[model samples]
Target chain A: MKIIVCIKQVPDPEHAKMDAKSGTVVREGVELMINPFDLYAVEEGLRLKEKMRGEVVAISMGPPQAEEALREVIGMGVDQCILLTSRDFAGADTWATSYTLAKACQKIGDYDVIICGKQAIDGDTAQVGPGIAAQLGIPQITFVRKIDEISEKNIKAERLVEGGYEVISSPLPILITVVKEINEPRLPTLKGRLNAKKAEIAHWGPEEIAADKDKIGINGSPTKVDEIFTPDLSKDGKIFNIEQLDAAAEEIVKKQKEMGLI
Target chain B: MGIKVIKEKCTGCGICFKVCQYGAITMAEKVHTLENGKEVKRLAVIDLGKCTLCSECVKPCPTSAIELKAEAHKFEGKENYKDVMVFAEQRRDEFEEAAFELVGKGRELADKLGVNLYALILGKDLKGKGEKLISYGADKVIAISDDSLFNFLPEPYTNILIRIIKKYKPSIFLAPSTTQGRALLSRAAGKIYTGLTADCTGLDVDSSGNLLQTRPAFGGSIKARILTPNMRPQMATVRPKVFKPLDRDPNRKGEIIEEKVPADLLKSTTKFEKWIEDTTSAISIEDADIIISGGRGLGCSDNFKILFELAEILGGAVGASRPTVDEGWIPYSHQVGQTGKTVGPKMYIAVGISGAIQHLEGMRSSDFIIAINKDPDAPIFKVADVGIVGDLFEVVPLLKEKLKRAING
Candidate 1:
């Protein structure tokens, strides 16, 4: 089984800022990390590789610095890493991004399974995973919390729904978007870090993947961001000290009563 | 400019009918003689008399059966679209409360736009549920009744919704930002080629008729208002509990249109095996009225038991910060933050939570907030209506005793 994991390098959202005048995200001077959720995907891929004796490849689409994320994943035990970076790929929405990733998958060719985080925190759009599955015409199960069983030909997993969990089974060459409950990601060891430093990172661009110029970036995206502005948070409230804890609790109960909530 | 169904590609999914606010599309059984003299199937038919040529139904046809006769002329301006439509999501044969909440907000937006408010409902044998929606302020209810729709599946649901949008051409579309809603609406929006604002904390229409979608940006440090000025059928997914539902009026009456779904379109690549409800968290954190959440400051997983006990006494639910959940102290379902679940309860009590912006993003909208932390400078105190600068272990036990006595009295 050949398992591929898709990861992304995101500006640490905690420190990420937005340019007020331009209404665009400002990444300068911000710390970058492997999208926290993607760590679980890479770990799951590595675990599956360890169990099934197959190679695990980590793929990421971003600026050149995204190679850092791939190299970090390599240290987590991935056999190979591929970085799909290009100027043409900038400003892509979920559809265009998924299209490019699907094209990269086609270039990679032989693969039994693809894994991705349920959503990227920065975009907060879970569309890319399903969009990739749609583009590849493969079965996809998103919000997967557990892998119940896995074989060379088929895989069964428990995916999260609105109110419950659904156990779904899909054939090989399928895509699964994992949630945080899946497994705890392991830290990189000294030997693993040494191997990561020596590993060769493959770089692929639009031409290498045979991607269409019109469909690889902003031009291919259907939706466009028309405007962005800061929201008003001007409401005022009272704050009390620890000595006033009982009084505050009493006031809250009183307010709840006024609002007809027991 | 009217919508046309390609006979060969028509799957009769009835998504067109479900979305049509004008009741223009209907599923009818048609017999066609094969070359060998065999008869066949039913298809969706469009009534030109009732159709307003909105060209909204073209996208949701599973097989791409529907098309606008003149694509360029179909959407000449925003004037062609009318009314606000809310996707009334259902689960286990019942409507989610968020459905009513969206309808409530839809009602306000529709009234502002001076158009009718329509609720698009899809489910299995949802008899009389349309009436319930009407009581909650839906001017008209378009329902697609099918057994396959009992559970939310992205492909079929998205296809149906896209067809509805193409046929009815609602000016605004609202869906609850739940997991199912996000999946369904995102795919449908992609097919419809429209901009969708996800997890909006606030929604309103500008004087120029553009939907103003406000959501937290850069991890709750700031809120951003996003707009899609050049798009039709403005789409937004609203978080649950942000708005209150209207008072129910059983005496209210509205029109209900029922549509059928084609069996072929229901065939999907994925299959559902079984539903396992998380019995431990019987009430989801999103729906909880009062929430008692703990954070890493609580020390360890065993410390969570006291918070759970406090929650039980308060008749509320237990919630945790992302760190505690990441530490494996609690399940992800109990997490309250940007990555976990956004909640707006009546009252939120934080025990030993340091109030990271990410954590505040989820619970900031709560009506009343009280924070308990030993550190006086914890960020949580900035947003908390009351701050207790004391040890949680000592403060929590005292507060719980006071609450138990108060409730008993």
Candidate 2:
């Protein structure tokens, strides 16, 4: 069971604030962390590796700093990691990003499974995982909440849908995008951290991966953003202070009642 | 490797630096050897590592110094592509509300482009069902009803959609942003080498007959207008409830043709064993008139019970913010935020929610919003109709008691 998990480093959503005046994000003190959902994917990969006794490899396509994210994952028991960083990979939409990642996977050659988070917090597209699977022409079980069964040949998983969950079974060399409900991520052990620090992270660029020049970056990306602007969040709503909690509560109730809203 | 600052065009105005939200842009002092003396010019340098390529900074530059170099893909047989087609996602022979919404929007776009609106009904037992779309707005509905097409396996669904797309080149394609819809359509678009924008809240056909897809990016903090200018079928998945479904007209007539997909192409490596329908979805937050949503301020999972109690009293459904849902306090089905469901209830009571812009995007459309948080400066208060600066554990109970007494009396 050769497990491959894809992760992303994103600005912490809690600290990713906006400058009201400029209508742009305020990034001075914002910190970067592994995309919250991807942690579950990594955890699932680690669990699968522990059960099946194969290597769990983590892959991330980001700037050089994104190597820090891969190192963190390695500290959490991933056998090795790969950092796909290059100027050619900039401005990638889901298609280009997936294409590049898929090409990287092909370069890795032999792999049993590819796991990814349902979606990244920043983009919120949830398109890349399926896009990669599509480019690879492989089976995909997206929004997977749990892995019911697995073996060298096939796997059964529970996928989240609109109303409920669906139990799906797929053959080997499959891709699974997992949601947060999948599992709780484990912390890095002292020994694991030491190993992570000593591990030499493999670096791959377009040339190294044999990526097609036409499908490597922004130029290859089919969709182009014509315009970008901040959403106007300037709604003027009334505010009321609380003196005694009970009195404030009663007033609000009467207010809703008087307004015929209760 | 495209985004760059043209040194010759740059005046060192430093406007792009201020507009860059990613902190990727900085003013670098470059010594320019003038005719008389050396002059230090502050040129804007963009760090590719931090730049998301959102292209926001490009608009504010007076000199048009920054350029994203990419050729608009050219199609050889572009003239052959015609009409607008919608996926018409259905389960158990019943079309989702999103399908109807897409049909209505598709009808509008089709009219604007002087083309037809075609709906694809791909599923099992969809015998008389495809015609329902005609009443809403579809000009033609292609129904691919077969056993292999029953379950929405990504591979099979993608193959079927690709076949239809290849056969009839629609100028535009739309789908619901449901889990199945996103998974299936992304695969289809990728396989076909076309663009597919996700969770678009706005859709319109531009003057050049190009579909202008508008969607939120950066966790709903920013809006992006995307274009698949050179592609045959410009694809996008629309956020549910963003558009209203057109009224059904029995008098309206349209064509409904059943198409067959070869069994080999419909073969799915992924098999669906069972579907445990969310029985609780009957009271889903999307349809609720009053939604009392909790957040991290609720403290822990035990705190959700209060929200449920309040919801039960009001006969409404309980909702949770992204954090609470991500915290596993409640199910993802109850999450009401950007990454979750977009909801517009009559009355939304935010208990302990500090309203991130992402959460606000989903519920800001509510007719009346009441936010209760200890922090008066909480962003939720900014958009809330009634802002209560208090603790939820203390405030929620008293408010519930008063409301319960008033309703009973």
Counting clashing residue pairs in each candidate, in order, gives: 9, 0
Second chain of candidate 1: TM-score? Answer: 0.78
Among these predictions, the greatest TM-score belongs to 2
Off by over 4 Å in 2: A18-25, A241-262, B8-13, B19-23, B34-40, B48-52, B279-281, B286-290, B296-306, B309-316, B322-329, B336-347, B356-368, B390-409
- Expressed as tens digits, the lDDT of each residue in A144-175 for candidate 1 is 99999899988889987655688878778888
Worst 10 residues of 2 chain B by lDDT: B31-40
Which residue pairs show backbone clashes in model 1? B12-B262, B13-B262, B56-B165, B56-B166, B56-B167, B57-B166, B57-B167, B60-B162, B60-B163
How good is the docking of model 2, as DockQ? 0.54
Model 2 residue pairs with clashes: none
Per-residue lDDT, model 2, residue B31, is 78
Clash total of candidate 2: 0
Question: What does each candidate score in C-alpha RMSD?
Answer: 16.4, 3.7
